[model samples]
Target chain A: MAKHSFSLSPLSSFILPRGDTLFYLIALFSILSLLIHHLSPVSAESRHFEGFDADEIDDFGDSDEPISAAKHIPPPPPTTTLSVSDPIESHHGPPPPSADPTSQVTSQPSDPKPASTSFEVWDEDEFEGIPQSPPSDSPLITESDTAASAESDPSLKLEPESEPESPKSISSYTVEIVCVSFLIMFVINYFTGKKENEKLALAWASKFATKDSIFDKNFSLLGVGETDDSPLLLKEGQNVFKFYASGRRFCQGLLATMELKSRHDLISRLYNMVVPCKDEITFEVYMNDDAMDHVVVAVAKKKLAKTMQKETTDLQRFASLVSPPSGKKWIAEELAVVAESKEVAGDMLNETVLDQVFGDKAYEKFGKGFISMHFSDQHLGSHKKMLVFKFALPDAKNMADMTRLVALVPYYIDLIGRYKLSSHARTKTDGARMKVAQEIYKELQNARQEALQRKKAEQRKKGEEAEAKLSAEALRKKEAKERARQMKKAMPKMKMTRTG
Target chain B: MSSPANDPRQPSTAKPYKPSPVAPQDLPIDYSGFIAVICGVFGAMFRYKICSWLAIIFSAQSLANMRNMENDLKQISMAMMFGIMGLMTNYLGVGPRGSKKT
Candidate 1:
């Protein structure tokens, strides 16, 4: 103990007032540690747990040159020094140097060089990597770039070391701020990306985007491409034109749209590929999916109208044809046959067999009338009556029945005029019905002509008829009076005798 | 593990050895260095811009129809989409929605 006290150097030669104070604190603590070490039980027993360490054993050797640390305890100021240098090597330096480099005027060297050695002590400054950064503009910033420098190395998991003054106190408030800022940035970026991606996907899907490119292609290529875009159109068109003359027809509405579109079987594969030509093609675009139904309906409507028109024109021609010179023999033969067979059957009369004998429409008209005789006697006596032949439409309200009866009126009239002038179908049915209907028609025509002629004569005779009648009446009356007077004269003797 | 040479209580030095500057378990971080890392990663991903850019080029039907001399084009768009998605997912440590958990 005496030797130790004698060997103690005056580290006050180097220590500042504050440094000396901390130095004595360390010395006092070290002495207390030594006294505790020797005076306490020597054995490693229950009092000392696993982490407990003794520094008294290190007193002589570890305290060798750094007499400032000769007490075998590090001063607080030196531990706090911020150096870019390594701590362990610097802590082994001369007595006052290893003690405290932290107090700006007290312990740190005035020259930054040898102090640079003491600066190395900061390498041993054990922070949890939470640094104390001075203002960035400070020249001390250069001291922080070092790869292994104590002030330079970031010891925490998050945040840049440039934020050393960022409050090493590690408050809950600071941590929360960092987390919230990070979360806000993440959320903002996420929504922006999501919305733009959705728009891009939609714009990509729209088909007019490519339709401009599909132009100028050939029919088959266009068909294939069209089917590639939409298979429904091809399948529909093929179903309609059963005997499709056109190669690779692109017509839609030719087939069943709804049914086939649902069936994706392998067999429909070939039909699926047919597409339309890209040019001015005849296909009408239907908004509805049932493309084939409307196509057939449009075609049928056109055909029915055409047939009706043709039939009307043919009947007109046949009416005048019966008067032709060549029509004589045929008309006679048809008239004889109809008279023999009371009812001409079926559309047989409407057909051209006996029509060659009579003219066609006239035969059809007459035969149809004979078939519709049921309602022909509606004005008969009150007794309900039955006809000789039973008709399917007993009422004659059947369009066929009505057409037949009404048609006979003109037909028979026409036939008689022809028969009177020539020999066309004067058979009993035709001749009899024709004669009666002819007589009626002639009487009607004569009456109509006479009435019309009478009207004309009335215009000529307005004054003449009245004057002629008046003159005749006047002459007769004059003659009668003259006779009366002559008689009286001739009978004068009788009159005298009568007077006598 | 008990070595007399490493006994802290019987430290042979003239002075007690201060513990190492820091505990061994703590990582050595250079927070300034991470600023460059953040910039580099963001720049690379931004420049990669693979999906948006390639889609625009293909017009969303973004087919890479590389034709042979005979002019036969091959379809490789689907595979490219998967590859790009895989790269993005790996960096994020996750998989896409509706993917089977294998």
Candidate 2:
């Protein structure tokens, strides 16, 4: 017995968990489907059941008076004989005597009339009796009949009978309520967020980009209409605004794009809560070929400066971190610089600009908003000489805080456009660029050579594999055919005559 | 420094700066990427496996030929989130209503 019990333990443990999970899953699924089915529009069968239950309950209430009155009267012999004829009728046949007086008084005094009327009332009462008599003589038959009727009709009878029990059914619809609430929240956030972003962008444009503003005096804002009263900014997307300015002294054009976070999307809003980010505006100024000398300089926050050097193609190839001039202290402890040479860094970060913009007092006011500034003459891609400035946007209420930073765009545009490299610095920059170009060319050539060699080796391997796969007899035949071809080539070409 | 316009000795007329015209290269909108995001959102909300799988496929195609990294990355991430959410809800949750009835 112990051995048998031990053997059964493994089987029970293995089968029980799976069986339990399946059973629970099926139960949950059925419950969910039933809830959905009931919540749908009322069907014909449900309407029929509702009307039938209401009428049946009223009829039973009216018949109760007659049933009580007939109980005192003596039972007729004919009614008793009819009750004993059928087993199903006999189960409720004792109640027939009570129904007989109601049929006799309401319909006719004839004996056949009483019997026929009594049978008709008892047939309807049989359906009602199934639920009423749980302890009847034949429970199996009654239980099966009650279950079949219950399956056809919903258990919603209690809903009309009692008002307080309706809340129990409502509690089961929590899933649908939650899903609908989420959809509502998403829609509300989308429209409100879009309007807010548009308001911020328009505020920025009105403050810094309109007529007589810093941008208007330095660069031309092309108007859509003939008049200058046209809008100064173009709304490109929900969160992106663009300002195109041309007619500057040294640059071809300036494209300023403000890229805000996707506040309109619910998923993006949720993601932003976990991983914090900032909205930024970038300036891309394309310079004329002769406007800039050989200089590549970048100044940024220490953390971002490292990323720029790693990610930017031109910065990675042409610039490296540089120290300040011998007697001068670095720009700021929080700042980092990457440049081709020390002179370019010095020329770019001069005394006047430093005191007005990046000094300790000014840095405190504007440092948080300032992200990075990169100026490169040998920048890769279509435009070789370019200037890029990135700044974080403050809230719309504080739009005036960035006046000094915005002014720097035109200031640097004029400074770099008019400035020229020293003779000594120019020679060094030219030589460095030439060396980088030569190294890139050499790398390309080496890659091509390696590819060619790889192809040759692949071909040789294929030939060997084919030979190895051949049978001995097939290999001999191939070799003999090759030998015959070689001998034919070795001998001088001879004219051959075929005789038939 | 004297302004050229202010100098009496110089001519009053000075040419206004006219920038050289450059060709415009307008980037086309990524319709497939946007479709993927919409499909993914529907899939997650309605628990549709086919829509979720289509979102993933369109996202891959969008990523392969991406031109702008910053903008494309944001759209791609949103699509991926909805697609994965849809798959998790369909396979790992109670599944679709039709499948449950079967």
Candidate 3:
């Protein structure tokens, strides 16, 4: 049994770790191909031309025989006769054949230039040999003279020069075309992949936040305070969230504005405070391993800022102290939860983190319809400074859901802070933990029920009061009618006595 | 009754020699270098830019391994040189008939 188990283990391991085997095979094949390439060298004999005589045999028998035959016999005689007939045929009846042939034969050699040009028109290959035709007519003509004239003719030289240059240009063009096409495809693919990743991230965030089926209206960017650099395209205290609600995609976010006593990197401090307790408990939905590196406060576009906002609802989805928003959208802005500490804890507290954590203008940086919030300096009369926390959803359709999430930001921060401070506050056992969570859930449910009941009672009271007022008014009108009738009867009697 | 020690025809065994199974360290065959050279050849032959780049990358790796691996120094250097040349020329598409020299 032991041997069998050990044998099975090897098999399982080999099957499980497939990547190693694949790499090994690839390396083996490459080495094999190389050895084959080296041991049996490829010769250039397959590519080399055997001899020029072979080309002559193939060229002469098939495609070029007519060109050769036309060169020697018919080109000269026909061309000369055609030239003579133009003058003779116009003057009188067709010249006698006897005189015509003799006259054409004499005229052919005299006008060699026209004869050669006409032969070239009949067949292109025939013109190639015509250069030698002039030389053949009188061998005394020097070789250097013919060469000079051939060089002088620009058309003759253009063909050979252009042919050699073609292959070089084609290769270059292929490289350029492949590179350009690949670049275009890469750019397009990158953008599409980025968009797909954002969508996936949003879906993952939604598990922690709100998930409302009904698409709501009234999405807007509300300016909370004053800032030099703001994402919102609005004045202080202005609400631009719902202006484009009709034509806009739905987005949700959390925005918190508070006053701070002094200028500090509050968000970094909060992160540091939580770092100690991160092992015991985790905000897995809002926090990733990379979140430590990603905490940044910067100006972003409205669409980008509201990418990670969550939908809002009355009830808490998760039984945590901080009720994370219903569903999350991609938040374009970097958010920092504010905290203040006198001394640094470890090397973790770096300058980059501090710069990323505090002092961001959420309103002006993001445009209208963004999840816009800001901190006011002048408004902090007694306090040192103000903190404005905002969360933006990418494509939020419902305004009510976003507003609800925004309303929960303060509670979320307070609960999160509380959890961080009392790391040992959790129950000892799983059963105990469950009981505590259930008790809290029950309490929240009770509170919600109580609030609903109170609203119903108030509405009932208002209805009763309105009904009473209506009946009392009717009674007063009836009483007045009775009194006027009585007064009218008395006035009539009095008018009768005084000739009324 | 057929005792080998007593038999006149039996041959005596006196510590037979055992041969080593593994090859010597100083052999010129470096698998990594040869693989790189092969990649360069195929890439140049097919005019594949990506493969040429692969050849360049593998050749760089081979060069780095030259210090550690037990390959002949001359052969390794030659392979590296050829690999690099093949990569660049193949990428340009102008070596000996559009880099068709496999």
- Between candidates 1 and 2, name the one with more favorable TM-score: 2
Q: What is the per-residue lDDT of model 3 for residues A135-166, given as tens digits with 9 covering 90 to 100?
A: 12222212333445666785433112111112
TM-score, chain A only, candidate 2, equals: 0.61
Report DockQ per prediction, comma-separated.
0.01, 0.06, 0.01
Clashes of each: 30, 0, 40
CA RMSD of each candidate after superposition: 49.0, 18.2, 31.4
Candidate 1: segments with Cα more than 4 A from true spot: A1-500, B1-60, B63-73, B86-102
Question: Fraction of native contacts in model 1?
Answer: 0.00
Output the better candidate (1/2) by DockQ: 2
Question: Candidate 3: deviation at residue B96, Å?
Answer: 13
Give the chain A TM-score for each candidate: 0.13, 0.61, 0.21
Candidate 1 DockQ category? incorrect
Worst window of 10 by summed lDDT in candidate 1 chain A: A291-300
TM-score of chain B of each: 0.24, 0.67, 0.48
* Candidate 1: tens digits of C-alpha lDDT, residues B1-102: 111132111112112111123332343332212322333233233533333223222221112112111111111322233333323433332223231111
Mark the regions of model 3 whose C-alpha exceeds 4 Å error after superposition. A1-22, A25-167, A170-316, A319-500, B1-102
Task: Report the poorest 10 consecutive residues by lDDT, candidate 3 chain A.
Answer: A236-245
Model 2: TM-score for chain B: 0.67
- Cα deviation at A385, candidate 3, in Å, is 27
Per-model TM against the reference: 0.14, 0.57, 0.21
